[model samples]
Target: MSSNVAGRVVCYSVLSPPRRSRREQIISQLLTSVGSLREHNRTVRVVVFWLGSRHQETEDRLRSLEAQVVHLGSYEDLLHPFPGGDVLVRYPVLHKYFVLDAVLEDLGTSQLLLIDCDTVFLDDVDKLFERHADVDLAACAEVGTVRRERGYDPAYLDEEHLARLAQSLGGRFVEPINSGILLLSRKGIEELAKLRPALLEITLRLMVGLAKSAEESDFAPLVQLRERLASGAPEVKGVAPLGFPSSNHWIVEEVALWLALGLTESLTMRDLPPSDAALGGEVYRRPRSASSWIIGHYFSVDTAPAMSWCRTGQPPHASPKGRSRAADELPIDPALAASPLLVEHEGFALYEDLFGLDVLSEMTREAREAYWGGQEQSLTARFGGVGRDSHPPRRLVSAGGGDVQDAAYCSPSLKAFLESLCGLEVEPTGRRGSVNYYTRSGDFMGLHLDVVQCELVVLTVLQDLSPADDPSGSWELFPGQVGRPLPSVSTGRRDRRSIKAMPGQSLVMFGGLVPHRVRPVAAGQRRIVSALCFRAGQTALEPPTVPQD
Candidate 1:
């Protein structure tokens, strides 16, 4: 039953050594599912990559069902020299990534459909192939409902994980891609093959770093064993920086695939519609529609019983355990808890006390001295304007001291914390030169949205006088239109919300989205604030501004 024929869709499934009984049961169901594809008029072939010692009975069973089975030699060769070999060995599910490229090479098929063993076909997969014919890859997007049901939370990822994602995906994260069902064209397969070596090295380094950090755990012995095996291997180098382990080992494949696709030029990715019926482990029935459900994924809560029924030819038993609550109960790291609290509202988020009081106090003193020493300059003429008419002058002084920059923009913790809150990785715009604003009595900034240079603006209040001293000088936020000129500060618009930032408080706002201004200061008051700018992801440059009406 060699199905290595070209111009046909080869459906590939990898089965590593599982319990003998369970493996047989899954293969039986998988063969039946593959057989059903023929009735749907699909020109398809089924091939199973078995990673274990050759079992004649298993090979005979698959052949009887008209499916080809190839026994992959000792899996140890795939794991030996990699830096994170131990971790991979511990979690064998990750083996898919190491062997998938080789499987594709062996099959030599221009079109490949990779599915989990538990998945069943309810409809013709011909449409799926046609839909992705012009694209490099097509995969289902892991929806929020499915992720929550599966107990996966993106927020649980820490700074190092976020950094890896940023380096790999050009963003903090892309919509999670399910690895259970992947449709790859020849280009996509070749791309993965080309990037496999570098990707494996990086993945191993990250895993080794994580293992080294957990030296006292029960897992430490496994790492040591792997280290001994890798001692003579040239690929075994010093540990890389540590990052958090993914919720499941299979996530390694998803990450590697994403990175490979991202780095591969001339290849595009498209989302397979949820309606295409890629059901999860929830045991959802085939949807009643004009077309049948395309694929059913049995990797979730109900997989074992479904497999048991196929094995003994008996009704499936109720799942012994329901969905896992571990993900919900997972502890929030102390570092995350200690990060600044972001209170969100329409159009903005207010981060209370982002900087310590002592730091702000010292910075305030420096800014006041700069103003008094005549180092301040007028910023109104350059940045604040409504077409040709510039607003009244406001005093602007540099952060001047490196300490302020370190506290505000250069702190890794601060950057990570902000990224967590925003759910987007941000970087300094490199347009550094932050400034401290000093507004004396009678000074007021006009109502205008900030320029589109930065994705977000961080404002630290160094000194805010008491309401009694300066009730009129609070930052007045206008909610209605963006980019359009609003009525003057004295217009007393009922929609405006006045925000008073006390000393040490920080305000983080989507600069290009919210239009705001400074209220006129009272005679005895002086308002001082430090402002910094950041751009989200690498592509967020100076966006087009809203049209001025």
Candidate 2:
């Protein structure tokens, strides 16, 4: 197919199934992404490439819009070169590139947004182009999603990957890039197309590296992939393997794309605003704000992962209720200056009077009212790390909602103060704010990483009747122990430090990386605190990463 008119085109590469749910998903992406783009930019054309089994109704629906639907032959046809195409057919990521390559050939020098079918454009495509007009390509950095170290099983090493990539990339060690939402200029597209052969070599090398590093019995997928490469076969079995772990396959495509991008020296490139382009598995972690979410990429179409992913966030009826927030600039310069930084540890920070304390009055009053008003639940469970070994009993009073919840969800003052101290801009997360009460004698949470949750968490002591200095009923840290450990607070290790964020004070830390817990409450003591979550701010210059959900 040839484009009659195009300055830039928003392209989607899809592999749909016959299932009703999947059809609904495709329609959702179409309705949201195409709808949003059409509402904002008419100059940009929308192109849909169907790379799997075709359904006539969906094809007709695609035709109804300005979208030019391009039907690529079935996945089996794509695997023609692979002798036993059945094995790798399910994940057509590598083959998807062929469709994209065809697009470049037909469209010639038109700029493009090459994205996955599960992705939705939350904002204008034209505005995105104008904002990054200087760059030939832009994509989110995916270093956080893929691990660079070898675990018990063989894995790719970042150091070696970068060394090899840098050699081809003019001595630049570019971090891995996610191909989910790519913004590419004409030069970028041509350069990407040029990398076809080399990228294949890199991908095969990756398969070899993983195969070489492990025993054949350790990784079945690596063994099969290695065997196919050795025999120069296109497919493993006669057909695509059923119920394959598609996640790992997608990672290969992401790494291949990263290496391919690195090989391009003629084109200028940068990272897309991370918060704006919420990549696969990250869609849920992003805060529910329109300006904050300009794009979303779902990881899977399978019922299991997709269902869980869908539950992460609700479909917003509109952009948001108000105007976009101002960028958080540091050194808040509050006249009080009461919130002094006490000490900064590895991932934890100690502050005496954090700016979030200003809301303690209302927050505490609300918590008290809610607790007395019987809008609270007494939770009793042994909460610890991922391990379920020896967890101590934990009891706490939990309640949601108050006058301060909404304001806390996106607080500029606290964000400013945190940015000043941490030296990194942050955005308020936590879609709903809630209060945790440690009024019971055994109210304590064991050490655990927040994991796949907020990067930074702020805990403000709204009202603590316990002895401020007592370690029995306050927050405590295992001090730099990121390793997943079911550590007991009763061990009395000297490294264990109980934080004294007394009434009106707060403690902030990388909750996702650091291992922390709260001590049990004393018999007569009462403690109430509210937590505010945040993530490192995303900008075109920097990458935003939320741990994979």
Candidate 3:
């Protein structure tokens, strides 16, 4: 009954065996999760429920891990109320709820923590128990859904059926919760037991209705359900008036739990702040500085490589062999080391006048003139040999194939300087440099990581014609941070750190690892920049051609 008991009890379920590779993946995840949990909480007790036929290797592994394994028997009697044939056999997720029910029936513990096997503890979770001590159930809100939007749509729900279900619960449905990481007390379990029958009935009805409706409509049942949920329905019975469609095969348990909590008068549900617990891909991409993150669910197959590397401290290769380039080997220049622009932890540097002012000025002038002349000639030819009255400038051009600016950027002295500063031997890629000429307002580059061949990128500002007070051109960098995913063009701009680069200044970054972008240019502004790409350990006179821009 004490909070200590709750902190000690950690429960998880593995229902069926997947493919050989997936099985191995699950085993690895369990080992890492249990190992990490034991390291941080010596008194932690792990309980795993096996729902189907016995997997000897898995059972032995769990035993070796000092985990108590419970094999669940036939749930025919409990699932009989649901019209579906062998619901337990058909859907493995149902096993999680049944496992909890079995545990409550047998164990004397008043509180328990339910975690998915795909998750690992990052920090001590004692605070989580204390934080939700007063609540009957607590879980993280599901991302990419209306759960956090505080409103629900009705198109996905069988409105009349949902209205009937709400009448039975004496309340309405609320925002759905993710059950990946959950905390449940004795009272909460009891509430779920009372509501389980109605939950099953409603889910069965919804599933049948959607299946029947799908035969007549073009949309899938799940899609129709989601569409209906997105409709902003009025709140009813002190809960958000939302309904769960059973067509959502994977999230039935979560839907049932949400309904139980909202329908039960004595039960309470609390949203676990995202900062405290992250699920799926969000876990791998959580910021390293997020010390408050207690549980992380690396559930997605996309995160398998990262999870393997994080757990084993090695590359996820069959041969298990690889080389690493240590950052310490790169010595920093004492004079430039203390500059704020040099982010030592992120392997980047920003320098003013990296290229001499005179060189930059001459290159900028010539490039601008060449571009303008080319435009004028094109215009004159287009107008039947008559010189055009005025000519607009081209916004962008590839400054490659032996351009003067390209030659300046690839100078021997500059290459040597960069090599010394970063302690890495490098050579320029054969790809032509990009001459971005932003002449119009709102011209912007989205955040993105450079191609793999571009180990390093040297971006030099050739010209900025914006007003001195309203300089619109700036470099935004998403530095390489631990426990964070590589930022992408789709990510919000707020996550980036912007730096204004004056003409002649250069920004050096690990192009393939760090995500960087250029801010929009304002009206009446003319900004010109050059991007030079480099590869590691290649000194050949000619390099393979690759797109750099």
Candidate 4:
């Protein structure tokens, strides 16, 4: 069957019925998730369903993006006082349970990528199918330690009850998992329709039980309760809290899925990597480190300034980097504007058009032609050559032949430009430059600093075209982490930036001082990069000194 016959879908819910405020706020978030769709090879239909009266602007925006808007009546008409309906209106998060079954029915045999509204996708959502097609249920496991003692955790899921529910269903125990980002096949979804009555009962009972046992507190039902549970820390001490997993019931729908799974004899499940579908505070706090994460469940986060590309029938612009910003133009310094377009900061500047498109296009063509496709370099943990302090294997095919370097690396004008950026004269180091190929699927580079010889690191993504559905091989730069441990780059690196440099762009970083690595290359992706190193001295005459790695 052709893709035109039927396509897959990604689903999200937003600002519930009668709440017409925060229009642009939701639009930005919608763009964040919608913008991420460009990374996917197969076109995914965006379906926004809600128990609501539609906001005209949001509908118009969705129409402009060619998204299909599915409005399932109003809260007063569809789900008045039905079982679990009380919590559904009170907690907007639980609304998915009401809409997903219908979505699955329409999808028939195809699957659905059910995600939160505030999520930002990093790679393709189709990866869930590639990795977890065999499983009936797959979800991103809650990051960090699982506080079993708390019984009900961050997702407001009653893990203890869920464990017993799973045990009662099929003697299989499920951990505390976030259902905000979930994958569902029609096979399992079919069972959900048949079990809808029982599922609602289970949801009602769970909500009542958690609420009865919940401690007394004063948090405005939706906003205050959700914000605090998501960002704040209060004591649970084993007993249930007031709003968490109880009255608010953000995770009740996830719990309903667990209940429904028990009735089905063909239940199978897997946990997706947190690096791929991160949730909560991690989405906004450390986007650079979590940049490779394709889907971010940004529940209540509004400070996601570094918005990804939002290409829905429109050009990839919208952020400072992505085509459009607030005014569509940044405050340009007259002198800086006259030079090459760049996003400059203290020690970092992302040159949007370092080498003009035509020149770099030719350079990229030359580098690809010059590649000898040498032996596959094993940079994996098993392919150990560097000392004990070496990074996770830099597994990939590399050709460091001088021809390839000379073909693209040694540009006289480029070096002169670099001299200005570095504030000193520069010369190619012994490792002048090398073409690294992320040949096979799953190939990656662990976090590590460049060798001592690398003083000025210049890297350009010659060709990042990948046939893989989940192609997320981007350059993650850790400018803020110089002296820190190699693996420490993923967490809390304030200045870390995950960059997927286009063919025309180039980056100049003090590689020896900044720790960095490449995210794993997905299947059908051939990631080729041209990395060149240079040396700089205190004065133009003295031998250049290397920064300690």
- When 2 and 4 are scored with lDDT, the better candidate is 2
Question: TM-scores for all candidates?
Answer: 0.47, 0.48, 0.49, 0.46
lDDT at residue 61 of model 1 (Cα atoms): 64
Query: What lDDT tens digits, residue by residue, belong to model 4 across residues 240-344?
Result: 322223222334555665665566667566776765666554454342542566666755322222232222321111123443223322232232222221224
* All candidates in order of TM-score, best leading: 3, 2, 1, 4
Best first by lDDT, ranked: 2, 3, 4, 1
Better of 2 and 3 by TM-score: 3
Colliding pairs, model 1: none
Error of 4 at 258 (Å): 3.4
The residue pairs found clashing in candidate 3 are 152-231, 153-228, 153-229, 153-230, 153-231, 154-228, 155-228, 156-228
Give model 4 RMSD, 1 decimal.
19.8
Model 3 misplacement above 4 A: 1-8, 74-82, 145-170, 215-249, 287-290, 305-309, 312-549
The sequence of per-residue lDDT tens digits that candidate 2 reaches over residues 255-274 is 65666667656878777766
197-264: candidate 3 lDDT, tens digit per residue: 65664454444444334222112233443344345322111222234453223444555555555675
lDDT against the true structure, each candidate = 0.52, 0.56, 0.55, 0.53
- Please state the error at residue 324 of candidate 3 in Å: 20
- Mind giving the per-residue lDDT tens digits that candidate 1 earns over 1-549? 333565445455454443343344455556656755655654466667777666677678667656677666656666767655644554444555554565565554677777766566556777777767887777776522233333444432233464475465453344456677778787777776676665665565555554544322112233453574467444345545435434322244455555445554666777777556454432332222333457656552234334443343332322124533222222222322232322245456667777777777777765554332122232232222231122333433333323454455767887887787766666665433244544444455656544333556788777656563445767777544433433333335686767777677778775544567777666545566777766654324344221110
lDDT, candidate 1, at 216: 22
User: Model 2 has how many clashing residue pairs?
Assistant: 7
Please give the lDDT score at residue 394 for candidate 1: 42
